[model samples]
Target chain A: MEEGTASKRAAGRFCSICTQRKPALRRPKTLEQICRECFYAVFEEEIHNVIIKNHLFKAGERIAVGASGGKDSTVLAYVLSELNRRHGYGLDLFLLSVDEGITGYRDDSLETVKRNEIQYGLPLKIVSYMDLYGWTMDEIVKVIGLKNNCTFCGVFRRQALDRGAAFLKADKLVTGHNADDIAETVLLNILRGDIARLSRCAYIMTGEDGPIPRCKPFKYTYEKEIDKYAYFKKLDYFSTECIYSPNAYRGFAREFIKDLERIRPQAILDIIRSGENFRISTTTRMPEQGICERCGYISSQKLCKACVLLEGLNRGLPKLGISRIKAGNDGSGRPDEEPTRRGREVERPILESKPCGTLDF
Target chain B: MHLTLEFGGGLDLLCQSVKIHQVDVAPKDENAKLTMRDLLAWVRSSLIKERPEMFMKGDTVRPGVLVLVNDCDWELCGGIDMELEEKDVVVFISTLHGG
Candidate 1:
């Protein structure tokens, strides 16, 4: 519903949460006019409630927050650290980032992540595509051009985060994915008719069966709320769109979700609920679980997406991994295989939503 | 009316990367109270140096763009129709930017 701020129009109105101070925000999720103090309280409290309800963490758990130094991740890092300290969750938090090696874009954003490393007092680790896949996005774009480059970056980043988290020996990975992002993914998966991801895109936690289990503390939280939180709290975050993949297929879904949010803010949550409840028919064959024989990363196919995409780049055949469908097993795994080595922090970029066009794996 | 306008969440990039603007916004017609609608038009014509579409859709902001008046939500202050006062602080933040 379009928020009825006019009905309650007045800066003098007390906050709905505290009923003391002047309200500063109309919470998109609940349409509550809350003051700054109450906004911080409920925002953290709600996330705490979500964490407790979902049982997302344990006392001694080492959690790696997938930090891109963007508004969502930056705010997520700040709030997660705040909650952990305030609630005595006893979680060891670390910041993990993937460098896609986009020259101008990632270099600057990575600087933000570094500052966050100190500001939040969390240890930080970054893995780069140059190290992991032997190709920067700029290098890949030169050969592959802009068409479907997101596929390569998206595929590689999924593996990179897992690898980075694994390197940190973290029990679970947390990302800044919020309710709005989940809603957009639900719509994108449906539009693509990719039933596999559509079934689990709304999940609060994913990858439980694999290398690194990832959770979104903001899953039920609104994106606008996150923005307000970041803005009001004065969190330092990078906001430039990724240099590559400026107008992506996902952008359409994002814009559509935003439009829907303006018309009906509850539609964002409703969309997530719809995504969470979709039941795949028994007859539909889901992709079986498999590890990439190449890099040992988790994959449904014989070779994981990163492996296929990397091979495509290395072998001078960029389209080899460009499939919107399951990347095929058309070619043999590379004869030369090495352990998941330490990728040098060569370069990278991301921001706005889907920084570096990070799609759901 | 004298107003303090702030741009953030990448909106500042449209206006020569300046985050805050202090400008005198005179009522277009004698003594008519200045609403956000008028101020937006003024900002678009006079301040926003690029990508006006990112800031305005029709007479209001792009749907995801938030307007706050004097640190209070513009939505809570009647949104686009909200009237301004002397030295009022209006903040525009685009929540559409990814984190």
Candidate 2:
């Protein structure tokens, strides 16, 4: 104890783990009386191995991270930046956040992402639904109604990210979707009988010619572990649900998977591994994919869906615009061919007013 | 039984409800004709007929239209290359912005 105290006179910094100014204080987390330097080395070693094992960071690649200011993305940016710097992965890291202009939720999260940009020393870009369509998510919800808010956000944001990535010329885009998200998506696909999605959703999505390669470095990491890691590391992240994302279906799927995880901790991993092992039948007469006639985005036959919807909004036919709800099968036991049930007529004038955007197929 | 039908959401009134072969599922898989191709065809033809000006450039769907086959996105599956199976539900939602 006397020798330890003597050492305190020589060193001037505090221990980060213990948060003690006493130089002699031993940081139990680091398992040594080490300072921040030693702490970072030990912490980064584990992350380094994870990256290498997964081949996440490629040499001389411009990496664009889809940062939502959430725990998953923030941690992703932190770890990737650290690894890039410490291990010399030679990655030019940039942070990209697609702001769907969702009231309260996304606005607050974007503020956190701004802070993270400065803290992590990564360049950031924010694309908003308002900028692209001249209408906010809240505004769209009122016009299109809450029934399809998820559709607008998800679709618009997806195109926004892809377009943003292309503008930045990023070779890769890294999303923060972890194991829990992957597992939930798998079940959602199965329930919906989406064999195509079920077959292609892998943890490591390679960059295709037209579409940017999207990678999930934390693919193997669980949501709980990400939460714990963020807590332990004192990471600042936005923790809120998207205001318009009352996606009961996804929530149900998430709960179903979580319940299974209670019995088998590796359920998430198993689902992901299963996704890897599964093969899709490619012999079907697949829909023809073509560049969007307007934005030049890859679509099934020219004119990507985003451009079509954006054109609708631009033409002031907001009501006539398609929504995300229309993207999911409600399983309400009613077929699309069924007549509009009682009181469903209220949704018509809105669709009819838009001369250019009405669905007349 | 072949029935003339129209779809809801963005896939509203079909053009004359063209006659097509219908497959019956045991009350469970009857609504399985939805696919990215169907939605794209609907959007392309509808946009052409309704918004002829929008289609002045050509007969193609503009970007931001979301066609989901069961909660899974059509874009993810070969981007409209996805096949529709029997009893599969299709949802053609527009990704419009208006608050």
Chain A TM-score values for every predicted structure, listed in order: 0.88, 0.74
Question: Model 2: residues >4 Å from true position, as ranges?
Answer: A1-47, A315-361, B1-99
Q: Residue by residue across A236-273, what tens digits does model 1's lDDT show?
A: 99987787766688877887898999899999999999
Q: TM-score (chain A) of candidate 1?
A: 0.88
lDDT of 2 by residue, A1-361 (tens): 4344233333444454555533222322222444434444544575578678877667999999999988888888998898888789999999999888777878888999999999999999987766555557776676566776676666677767776787788998888877778877777878887765675665466445555767777677666445444544668877555667654467677666656664566777888888778776668665655555444456663445555565444444443336432322111122233222222222222221211110100
Relative to the true structure, candidate 2 reaches a TM of: 0.60
Model 1: CAPRI class: medium
lDDT (Cα, 0-100) at A106 in candidate 2: 85
